[model samples]
Target chain A: MPYNVDAVFQIAGIGIIVAMIHTILKQMGKEDWAHWVTLIGFIIVLFMVAMLIRDLFQTIKNVFLFHS
Target chain B: MIQVVGLGVVATILILLVKEQKPMFAFLLATFVGIVIFLTVIGKITEILKVLAHLANQAKVNQFFLETILKIIGIAYIAEFGAQVTRDAGQGTIAAKIELAGKILIMVMAIPIIITIIETIINILP
Candidate 1:
Protein backbone atom coordinates (compact mmCIF):
# COMPACT_ATOMS: atom_id res chain seq x y z
CA MET A 1 0.00 0.00 0.00
CA PRO A 2 1.42 3.31 -1.01
CA TYR A 3 1.13 5.81 1.80
CA ASN A 4 0.12 9.11 0.37
CA VAL A 5 -0.39 12.06 2.67
CA ASP A 6 -3.26 13.04 0.46
CA ALA A 7 -5.06 9.78 1.15
CA VAL A 8 -4.65 10.21 4.88
CA PHE A 9 -6.11 13.64 4.70
CA GLN A 10 -8.93 12.35 2.59
CA ILE A 11 -9.83 9.76 5.21
CA ALA A 12 -9.72 12.37 7.95
CA GLY A 13 -11.93 14.61 5.91
CA ILE A 14 -14.40 11.78 5.54
CA GLY A 15 -14.39 11.32 9.29
CA ILE A 16 -15.17 14.98 9.81
CA ILE A 17 -18.03 14.80 7.34
CA VAL A 18 -19.43 11.68 8.98
CA ALA A 19 -19.31 13.32 12.40
CA MET A 20 -21.16 16.34 11.09
CA ILE A 21 -23.82 14.26 9.42
CA HIS A 22 -24.19 12.03 12.48
CA THR A 23 -24.68 15.00 14.72
CA ILE A 24 -27.23 16.51 12.41
CA LEU A 25 -29.18 13.30 12.08
CA LYS A 26 -29.28 12.72 15.82
CA GLN A 27 -30.40 16.22 16.55
CA MET A 28 -33.26 15.81 14.08
CA GLY A 29 -34.55 12.80 16.10
CA LYS A 30 -33.46 10.17 13.65
CA GLU A 31 -31.08 8.18 15.85
CA ASP A 32 -31.60 4.94 14.00
CA TRP A 33 -30.73 6.48 10.65
CA ALA A 34 -27.76 8.25 12.22
CA HIS A 35 -26.28 4.99 13.34
CA TRP A 36 -26.76 3.52 9.91
CA VAL A 37 -24.96 6.49 8.39
CA THR A 38 -22.06 6.00 10.76
CA LEU A 39 -21.85 2.34 9.90
CA ILE A 40 -21.97 3.01 6.19
CA GLY A 41 -19.24 5.62 6.45
CA PHE A 42 -17.06 3.22 8.35
CA ILE A 43 -17.61 0.53 5.77
CA ILE A 44 -16.86 2.89 2.91
CA VAL A 45 -13.57 4.08 4.39
CA LEU A 46 -12.59 0.52 5.20
CA PHE A 47 -13.37 -0.63 1.70
CA MET A 48 -11.03 2.00 0.29
CA VAL A 49 -8.34 0.96 2.74
CA ALA A 50 -8.94 -2.73 2.15
CA MET A 51 -8.04 -2.24 -1.49
CA LEU A 52 -4.53 -1.09 -0.64
CA ILE A 53 -4.12 -3.63 2.13
CA ARG A 54 -4.97 -6.35 -0.34
CA ASP A 55 -2.13 -5.19 -2.58
CA LEU A 56 0.26 -5.28 0.35
CA PHE A 57 -0.70 -8.87 1.19
CA GLN A 58 -0.30 -9.95 -2.41
CA THR A 59 3.13 -8.36 -2.57
CA ILE A 60 4.18 -10.07 0.64
CA LYS A 61 3.01 -13.48 -0.48
CA ASN A 62 4.58 -13.21 -3.90
CA VAL A 63 7.83 -11.86 -2.54
CA PHE A 64 8.16 -14.62 0.02
CA LEU A 65 7.47 -17.50 -2.33
CA PHE A 66 7.82 -16.38 -5.94
CA HIS A 67 10.47 -13.68 -5.66
CA SER A 68 8.15 -11.48 -7.70
CA MET B 1 4.93 8.76 7.81
CA ILE B 2 5.32 11.83 9.94
CA GLN B 3 2.22 13.31 8.41
CA VAL B 4 0.19 10.25 9.24
CA VAL B 5 1.17 10.44 12.91
CA GLY B 6 0.45 14.11 12.89
CA LEU B 7 -2.99 13.40 11.52
CA GLY B 8 -3.60 10.80 14.23
CA VAL B 9 -2.76 13.32 16.91
CA VAL B 10 -5.09 15.79 15.31
CA ALA B 11 -7.81 13.18 15.12
CA THR B 12 -7.23 12.29 18.76
CA ILE B 13 -7.74 15.89 19.71
CA LEU B 14 -10.86 16.05 17.62
CA ILE B 15 -12.17 12.84 19.19
CA LEU B 16 -11.58 14.16 22.65
CA LEU B 17 -13.37 17.35 21.81
CA VAL B 18 -16.34 15.49 20.34
CA LYS B 19 -16.53 12.28 22.35
CA GLU B 20 -18.57 13.28 25.38
CA GLN B 21 -21.87 13.64 23.54
CA LYS B 22 -20.58 11.99 20.42
CA PRO B 23 -19.04 8.75 21.48
CA MET B 24 -19.82 7.02 18.23
CA PHE B 25 -18.26 9.77 16.20
CA ALA B 26 -15.16 9.65 18.33
CA PHE B 27 -14.87 5.94 17.86
CA LEU B 28 -15.25 6.22 14.13
CA LEU B 29 -12.63 8.97 13.95
CA ALA B 30 -10.12 6.97 15.94
CA THR B 31 -10.67 3.94 13.75
CA PHE B 32 -10.20 5.97 10.61
CA VAL B 33 -7.03 7.52 11.95
CA GLY B 34 -5.72 4.10 12.83
CA ILE B 35 -6.39 2.86 9.32
CA VAL B 36 -4.52 5.84 7.88
CA ILE B 37 -1.52 5.12 10.07
CA PHE B 38 -1.63 1.51 8.99
CA LEU B 39 -1.75 2.50 5.34
CA THR B 40 1.22 4.82 5.75
CA VAL B 41 3.35 2.02 7.13
CA ILE B 42 2.21 -0.33 4.43
CA GLY B 43 4.06 1.88 1.96
CA LYS B 44 7.31 0.73 3.51
CA ILE B 45 6.44 -2.95 3.86
CA THR B 46 6.78 -3.76 0.19
CA GLU B 47 10.44 -2.79 0.00
CA ILE B 48 11.23 -4.69 3.20
CA LEU B 49 9.55 -7.82 1.88
CA LYS B 50 11.37 -7.57 -1.42
CA VAL B 51 14.74 -7.45 0.31
CA LEU B 52 13.84 -10.32 2.60
CA ALA B 53 12.78 -12.38 -0.37
CA HIS B 54 16.04 -11.75 -2.19
CA LEU B 55 18.14 -12.80 0.77
CA ALA B 56 16.01 -15.86 1.54
CA ASN B 57 16.30 -17.04 -2.03
CA GLN B 58 20.05 -16.46 -2.12
CA ALA B 59 20.51 -18.35 1.15
CA LYS B 60 18.29 -21.18 -0.09
CA VAL B 61 15.97 -21.16 2.93
CA ASN B 62 12.95 -23.42 2.93
CA GLN B 63 9.97 -22.03 1.10
CA PHE B 64 7.75 -23.58 3.73
CA PHE B 65 9.44 -21.51 6.38
CA LEU B 66 8.63 -18.39 4.43
CA GLU B 67 5.06 -19.55 4.02
CA THR B 68 4.76 -20.18 7.73
CA ILE B 69 6.16 -16.80 8.57
CA LEU B 70 3.80 -15.12 6.15
CA LYS B 71 0.81 -17.03 7.54
CA ILE B 72 1.76 -16.18 11.11
CA ILE B 73 2.11 -12.55 10.19
CA GLY B 74 -1.30 -12.64 8.51
CA ILE B 75 -2.92 -14.16 11.58
CA ALA B 76 -1.30 -11.60 13.85
CA TYR B 77 -2.46 -8.68 11.69
CA ILE B 78 -6.00 -9.95 11.23
CA ALA B 79 -6.40 -10.83 14.87
CA GLU B 80 -5.06 -7.51 16.02
CA PHE B 81 -7.29 -5.67 13.56
CA GLY B 82 -10.33 -7.65 14.64
CA ALA B 83 -9.57 -7.02 18.28
CA GLN B 84 -9.08 -3.33 17.74
CA VAL B 85 -12.28 -2.94 15.75
CA THR B 86 -14.20 -4.79 18.41
CA ARG B 87 -12.74 -2.57 21.08
CA ASP B 88 -13.67 0.49 19.06
CA ALA B 89 -17.13 -0.94 18.68
CA GLY B 90 -17.31 -1.12 22.48
CA GLN B 91 -16.96 -4.88 22.74
CA GLY B 92 -13.74 -5.48 24.59
CA THR B 93 -14.48 -9.14 25.26
CA ILE B 94 -14.54 -9.97 21.58
CA ALA B 95 -11.19 -8.28 21.14
CA ALA B 96 -9.70 -10.53 23.79
CA LYS B 97 -10.94 -13.61 22.02
CA ILE B 98 -9.55 -12.44 18.70
CA GLU B 99 -6.16 -11.83 20.26
CA LEU B 100 -6.20 -15.26 21.86
CA ALA B 101 -6.96 -16.91 18.57
CA GLY B 102 -4.13 -15.02 16.92
CA LYS B 103 -1.66 -16.15 19.51
CA ILE B 104 -2.72 -19.76 19.13
CA LEU B 105 -2.40 -19.60 15.36
CA ILE B 106 1.07 -18.14 15.62
CA MET B 107 2.15 -20.88 18.00
CA VAL B 108 0.77 -23.55 15.74
CA MET B 109 2.65 -22.10 12.78
CA ALA B 110 5.94 -21.98 14.70
CA ILE B 111 5.99 -25.58 15.92
CA PRO B 112 7.37 -27.08 12.72
CA ILE B 113 10.17 -24.52 12.53
CA ILE B 114 11.10 -25.19 16.14
CA ILE B 115 11.24 -28.93 15.54
CA THR B 116 13.29 -28.53 12.37
CA ILE B 117 15.83 -26.40 14.16
CA ILE B 118 16.09 -28.90 16.97
CA GLU B 119 16.60 -31.77 14.55
CA THR B 120 19.32 -29.86 12.70
CA ILE B 121 21.13 -29.17 15.95
CA ILE B 122 20.95 -32.82 17.00
CA ASN B 123 22.29 -33.97 13.65
CA ILE B 124 25.19 -31.57 13.94
CA LEU B 125 26.04 -32.90 17.45
CA PRO B 126 26.03 -36.55 16.30
Candidate 2:
Protein backbone atom coordinates (compact mmCIF):
# COMPACT_ATOMS: atom_id res chain seq x y z
CA MET A 1 0.00 0.00 0.00
CA PRO A 2 1.15 3.49 -0.80
CA TYR A 3 1.92 5.73 2.18
CA ASN A 4 -0.65 8.24 3.38
CA VAL A 5 1.28 11.40 2.72
CA ASP A 6 -1.52 13.48 4.16
CA ALA A 7 -1.13 12.03 7.64
CA VAL A 8 2.40 13.34 7.80
CA PHE A 9 1.24 16.79 6.79
CA GLN A 10 -1.60 16.69 9.29
CA ILE A 11 0.70 15.79 12.18
CA ALA A 12 3.32 18.38 11.25
CA GLY A 13 0.66 21.03 10.84
CA ILE A 14 -0.77 20.29 14.25
CA GLY A 15 2.68 20.39 15.80
CA ILE A 16 3.44 23.76 14.27
CA ILE A 17 0.15 25.28 15.32
CA VAL A 18 0.46 23.95 18.83
CA ALA A 19 3.99 25.25 19.12
CA MET A 20 2.83 28.67 18.00
CA ILE A 21 0.05 28.81 20.56
CA HIS A 22 2.40 27.63 23.27
CA THR A 23 4.91 30.33 22.42
CA ILE A 24 2.23 33.01 22.38
CA LEU A 25 0.93 31.98 25.76
CA LYS A 26 4.39 31.81 27.26
CA GLN A 27 5.32 35.23 25.94
CA MET A 28 2.14 36.67 27.43
CA GLY A 29 3.27 35.36 30.85
CA LYS A 30 0.53 32.72 31.05
CA GLU A 31 2.92 29.93 31.79
CA ASP A 32 0.27 27.57 33.15
CA TRP A 33 -1.96 28.01 30.14
CA ALA A 34 0.99 27.55 27.85
CA HIS A 35 1.83 24.24 29.44
CA TRP A 36 -1.75 23.05 29.22
CA VAL A 37 -2.02 24.06 25.59
CA THR A 38 1.12 22.21 24.73
CA LEU A 39 -0.06 19.16 26.64
CA ILE A 40 -3.41 19.14 24.88
CA GLY A 41 -1.82 19.48 21.51
CA PHE A 42 0.55 16.66 22.25
CA ILE A 43 -2.32 14.49 23.38
CA ILE A 44 -4.30 15.22 20.26
CA VAL A 45 -1.45 14.17 18.05
CA LEU A 46 -0.79 11.18 20.28
CA PHE A 47 -4.38 10.03 19.94
CA MET A 48 -4.08 10.01 16.18
CA VAL A 49 -0.80 8.14 16.27
CA ALA A 50 -2.13 5.70 18.86
CA MET A 51 -5.03 4.78 16.62
CA LEU A 52 -2.67 4.12 13.77
CA ILE A 53 -0.49 2.02 16.02
CA ARG A 54 -3.52 -0.01 17.04
CA ASP A 55 -4.38 -0.71 13.42
CA LEU A 56 -0.80 -1.73 12.80
CA PHE A 57 -0.92 -4.17 15.72
CA GLN A 58 -4.17 -5.61 14.48
CA THR A 59 -2.64 -6.21 11.09
CA ILE A 60 0.41 -7.75 12.68
CA LYS A 61 -1.73 -10.09 14.74
CA ASN A 62 -3.65 -11.19 11.70
CA VAL A 63 -0.47 -11.86 9.77
CA PHE A 64 1.40 -13.68 12.55
CA LEU A 65 -1.33 -15.71 14.17
CA PHE A 66 -2.82 -18.84 12.67
CA HIS A 67 -6.22 -18.60 14.34
CA SER A 68 -6.75 -15.05 13.27
CA MET B 1 9.17 4.56 1.68
CA ILE B 2 10.02 7.81 -0.06
CA GLN B 3 7.04 9.45 1.55
CA VAL B 4 8.10 8.32 4.99
CA VAL B 5 11.63 9.53 4.44
CA GLY B 6 10.34 12.87 3.28
CA LEU B 7 8.13 13.17 6.32
CA GLY B 8 11.00 12.21 8.62
CA VAL B 9 13.27 14.82 7.10
CA VAL B 10 10.60 17.48 7.47
CA ALA B 11 9.99 16.50 11.07
CA THR B 12 13.70 16.59 11.87
CA ILE B 13 13.98 20.09 10.48
CA LEU B 14 10.95 21.23 12.42
CA ILE B 15 12.23 19.70 15.61
CA LEU B 16 15.57 21.40 15.15
CA LEU B 17 13.84 24.72 14.60
CA VAL B 18 11.56 24.33 17.61
CA LYS B 19 14.03 22.87 20.08
CA GLU B 20 15.61 26.17 21.03
CA GLN B 21 12.37 27.88 21.99
CA LYS B 22 10.26 24.91 23.06
CA PRO B 23 12.05 21.72 23.95
CA MET B 24 8.93 19.82 24.99
CA PHE B 25 7.21 20.45 21.69
CA ALA B 26 10.34 19.36 19.90
CA PHE B 27 10.23 16.06 21.71
CA LEU B 28 6.57 15.56 20.88
CA LEU B 29 7.22 16.31 17.23
CA ALA B 30 10.02 13.78 17.14
CA THR B 31 7.84 11.10 18.68
CA PHE B 32 4.90 11.81 16.41
CA VAL B 33 7.12 11.53 13.39
CA GLY B 34 8.49 8.22 14.61
CA ILE B 35 4.99 6.83 14.99
CA VAL B 36 3.97 8.06 11.57
CA ILE B 37 6.95 6.40 9.96
CA PHE B 38 6.20 3.15 11.82
CA LEU B 39 2.55 3.23 10.75
CA THR B 40 3.35 3.84 7.10
CA VAL B 41 5.73 0.90 6.85
CA ILE B 42 3.57 -1.55 8.83
CA GLY B 43 1.66 -2.66 5.77
CA LYS B 44 4.84 -3.64 3.98
CA ILE B 45 6.00 -5.50 7.06
CA THR B 46 2.80 -7.52 7.19
CA GLU B 47 3.17 -8.41 3.56
CA ILE B 48 6.69 -9.65 4.15
CA LEU B 49 5.54 -11.72 7.12
CA LYS B 50 2.79 -13.29 5.04
CA VAL B 51 5.30 -14.26 2.39
CA LEU B 52 7.61 -15.71 5.00
CA ALA B 53 4.79 -17.74 6.51
CA HIS B 54 3.86 -19.08 3.11
CA LEU B 55 7.43 -20.16 2.51
CA ALA B 56 7.59 -21.83 5.92
CA ASN B 57 4.39 -23.74 5.21
CA GLN B 58 5.73 -24.90 1.88
CA ALA B 59 8.82 -26.22 3.64
CA LYS B 60 6.62 -28.20 6.04
CA VAL B 61 7.95 -26.44 9.13
CA ASN B 62 6.00 -26.95 12.32
CA GLN B 63 3.28 -24.37 12.57
CA PHE B 64 3.69 -23.88 16.29
CA PHE B 65 7.39 -23.24 16.01
CA LEU B 66 6.89 -20.82 13.15
CA GLU B 67 4.25 -18.94 15.11
CA THR B 68 6.40 -18.79 18.24
CA ILE B 69 9.38 -17.52 16.29
CA LEU B 70 7.28 -14.87 14.63
CA LYS B 71 5.84 -13.76 17.94
CA ILE B 72 9.30 -13.52 19.44
CA ILE B 73 10.45 -11.38 16.55
CA GLY B 74 7.43 -9.14 16.87
CA ILE B 75 8.04 -8.74 20.56
CA ALA B 76 11.65 -7.82 19.96
CA TYR B 77 10.75 -5.20 17.38
CA ILE B 78 8.05 -3.65 19.54
CA ALA B 79 10.19 -3.67 22.65
CA GLU B 80 13.06 -2.02 20.86
CA PHE B 81 10.77 0.56 19.37
CA GLY B 82 9.27 1.40 22.73
CA ALA B 83 12.65 1.52 24.38
CA GLN B 84 14.03 3.85 21.76
CA VAL B 85 11.09 6.18 22.12
CA THR B 86 11.55 6.30 25.84
CA ARG B 87 15.23 6.95 25.33
CA ASP B 88 14.42 9.79 23.01
CA ALA B 89 12.24 11.25 25.73
CA GLY B 90 15.39 11.44 27.88
CA GLN B 91 14.67 8.51 30.13
CA GLY B 92 17.76 6.50 29.54
CA THR B 93 17.33 4.38 32.66
CA ILE B 94 13.78 3.50 31.77
CA ALA B 95 14.88 2.62 28.29
CA ALA B 96 17.51 0.27 29.68
CA LYS B 97 14.88 -1.41 31.83
CA ILE B 98 12.59 -1.77 28.84
CA GLU B 99 15.33 -3.46 26.86
CA LEU B 100 16.12 -5.77 29.77
CA ALA B 101 12.49 -6.83 29.97
CA GLY B 102 12.41 -7.46 26.28
CA LYS B 103 15.50 -9.65 26.44
CA ILE B 104 14.05 -11.70 29.27
CA LEU B 105 10.78 -12.16 27.45
CA ILE B 106 12.58 -13.28 24.32
CA MET B 107 14.60 -15.82 26.26
CA VAL B 108 11.44 -17.15 27.88
CA MET B 109 9.82 -17.51 24.48
CA ALA B 110 12.78 -19.53 23.20
CA ILE B 111 12.89 -21.93 26.12
CA PRO B 112 10.72 -24.59 24.50
CA ILE B 113 12.83 -24.65 21.37
CA ILE B 114 15.95 -24.81 23.48
CA ILE B 115 14.61 -27.72 25.44
CA THR B 116 13.73 -29.58 22.29
CA ILE B 117 17.20 -29.08 20.91
CA ILE B 118 18.82 -30.30 24.10
CA GLU B 119 16.58 -33.33 24.18
CA THR B 120 17.49 -34.21 20.62
CA ILE B 121 21.17 -33.75 21.34
CA ILE B 122 20.99 -36.05 24.34
CA ASN B 123 19.29 -38.71 22.25
CA ILE B 124 22.07 -38.61 19.64
CA LEU B 125 25.02 -38.60 22.05
CA PRO B 126 26.66 -41.97 22.88
Best by DockQ: 2
Model 2 chain A is weakest, by summed lDDT over 10 consecutive residues, at A1-10
Query: B34-95 in candidate 1: lDDT tens per residue?
Result: 65576567547658866876789999998789878877776677678779878889899989
Poorest lDDT segment (10 consecutive residues) of candidate 2 chain B = B20-29
**Which regions of candidate 2 deviate over 4 angstroms?**
A1-3, A26-32, A65-68
TM-score of 2: 0.83
Q: Which stretches of candidate 1 lie over 4 Å from their true place?
A: A1-68
- In Å, candidate 1's interface RMSD is 4.4
lDDT of 2 by residue, A1-68 (tens): 43455665676677777778888988999999988987887788778767766765666566555354
lDDT of candidate model 2 versus the reference? 0.76
**Model 2 CAPRI quality:** acceptable
